[model samples]
Target: MRSGVSRRTFLASAAAGAGALAGLLPRPLRAQDKTVKIGFLAPLTGPVAAWGKPGLDGCQIWAEWINAGGGINIGGEPHRVEFVAYDDEDDPAKARTGATQLIRENDVKFVMMLGGNSWPGVQPVAERTGMLFSTLLPSDLSPSTATLIAPAEVHPIYNVTAVDWLAANRPELKTAVICAQDDALGLPSVATYLAAFEAAGIEMLDEPLLFDPATTDFAPVVTRMLSKKPQIVCLDTCYSDYVHPICEQLFQQGFKGQILSCTLDFYDQVIAKTSAEFMEGTLFQFPDFDDPALNADFINFQKPNEFFAEYNRRHPGQWGAVSWEYASVMDLWKAAVEKAGSAEPDAVKAAMTEGGEGLHAFGKARWWGKDLFGIDNALVGNWPVVAIEGGKARIKEFRSIPDWYDKHGELMKKHMAAYNQMWDQRG
Candidate 1:
């Protein structure tokens, strides 16, 4: 909002919080030597920690960048950002404790979560305090939540883009199989893939495969999928920790077929377990940060090009679901804070949903998803269909999600009903 702060420049600098962010508090709001703090509530010690910690590191980079650039200008005064962190460990009870700790003890204004089960626990605390809460999981959105947003992703909705691409490109694959953990994120993905695969005209050769995270042997799981003889297999919202073992078994069984997933993080490990040839042609939603299409079409990142170079440099082979996602949310937050000229949660929420096109981490997009999620919190736009070629992953196209929603609205609702996870019940 200030002459010195370009939207692009502000987003880029505030994305990673590379500095301590302790010096970025608004001078007027500063209580003596104290600083402004934002809370990063994530699973830092559970099975999901790998997903949470990397994004926090990115947030650290963003805070540092903003603070270094003379901080954010609010009403002609400068404010630095300080990130206060708490580990929810992907558990409900711990998340509530962390939420209270950050709000009551630390007095943070904004709270970011890796979301999922952890979100349910912290939602009340966020509402009571009127603090801005961000979740990478759009399933966390609802009318009841006046302060929550899924600024970066609509995980399963984007996964449909891959299925759409595959349906048009690989018509020979007429049937498929699916496997997913029986959790919050997993259930919706199962419903989504069922709708996607069906809309693609791919028949299900077998019933959906459900795996327990505690289960150690995936050879049996792969054996079951092989028995169905599906031309394709869907890894519906699986954890990275599970993807390797499942893909390993798929390789050991030598089942060559089309594969789809919501993510393929640390897929290099998957390539090693399988062969480069076997891993090739796999489809997913996420993309490599350096994808050329992003540079040409998007203005959502701090510096998409430079950020990619630095991220890969600092933490090689580790980008996944929440890697740049949380930081991207921070960028949107900065824009909204500027638009509203305040950090109040209600003001930010109203600004986000004022009904025009909004800028998300992925280029400029429309704020949509009320029909699907019971709230318009997801930033809908062109999502990449990433595929593995000769073991190297690359984006093949940026497909429009709006068109697909137009065609398959009823089918998706049916799938959601089957899973008892209509947007109203996402919590």
Candidate 2:
């Protein structure tokens, strides 16, 4: 693996070459041939790499597409986009180091993070540097983190849409068992599922089974969850590493039930381990961009079908929940930079939330989260409910997350408090 300095040097060289080529064009066309760097500070080589590495890949495509046309227009000048990535390995101390380096050395205008345990490490740096940052997890938001935003992928909050869809469509499955690794990512999702199940009137078969992250064997865990004879099994945001083996155990134990989760990343591998028949009808929150639903008139993402095909061509069989999230953030950031007529963090952020709403990947969503995160920084709106059928993932429906919150917001707060997951409690 290349050192951080080496990677930066390579990217700088590539950016210089691109700029040189631009300079060859007519003088009027090369009005302002400059480069803007964005920071990808996340776990690129760890248990969480599934979420981070794929996102950087997608951002690469996004930058190529934008630069091929005309780069982001700021103050009537075009600036090429480049990415500088630093792997935090999901460690807080490493995250802090990465954030400082990306800001002071790389001079990134924006930074995107997976943002669970890593947020704390980056928060202080953001406070000090005033650099704009975006997180996939809205649970990381707080009133003090003014420069931080949840422009895409609301994480546990969006999990409610899946439960809502399940209860309305398959009401027969009234009882559920939930299991998750007890950690920053898992606990909040467990609370969200609890609130969602409660709102939908589905009974939790047992106290959520919180297991240690290091536990390699899942037989005993699955045995305990199955002891209650639940008609539904909810895997509350476990890492793909854990989700896959637990699924294999469910199949080995000969259990047939409706399986729900926050993600089914790399589900094809799970199907291979078990069987396609055994993996059918599993419900999760993310959709493959190739899904026709993304082409709806209200959807804001550009060229979803082509993006999916290009992504698969470049990185075969590596798509996951975050494959497009960071790229999606870039889409919003580019628009904001253009709208504000500058790439400065403060100006771009002001433009992003100027009207109290933003263009989410699904549609226009309100800038909300004050009641939950003690800050109105998360872009809340509709989220998709997906199911695996006939060996492929399909978007079953796009459900309103804001509508669900309006109906059960208090219930969600109660559950979040119970699990010490509310913003205040976390602080």
Query: What clash count goes with each model?
Result: 20, 0
Top candidate (TM-score): 2
In candidate 1, stretches whose alpha carbon ends up further than 4 angstroms from where it belongs are 1-34
In lDDT terms, which candidate is top?
A: 2
Q: Taking the tens digit of each residue's C-alpha lDDT, what string does model 1 give over 1-427? A: 1111111111122244223223444233443333457898987665666656656666778877766655665455567778898989888789999989998898887888878888888878877877778877787777777677777777777878899999888888898999988888798889888888889998998889888766767889889988988899888888766677788888888888887878887788788767889988998887766667667746566455566667667665555544666666776776677677776678777777678568766677888888987777778887888998878778898888878989998888899888877767654
lDDT of each: 0.74, 0.83
Per-model TM-score versus the true fold? 0.90, 0.91
Worst 10 residues of 1 by lDDT: 1-10
Supply candidate 1's per-residue lDDT for 186.
90
Off by over 4 Å in 2: 1-32
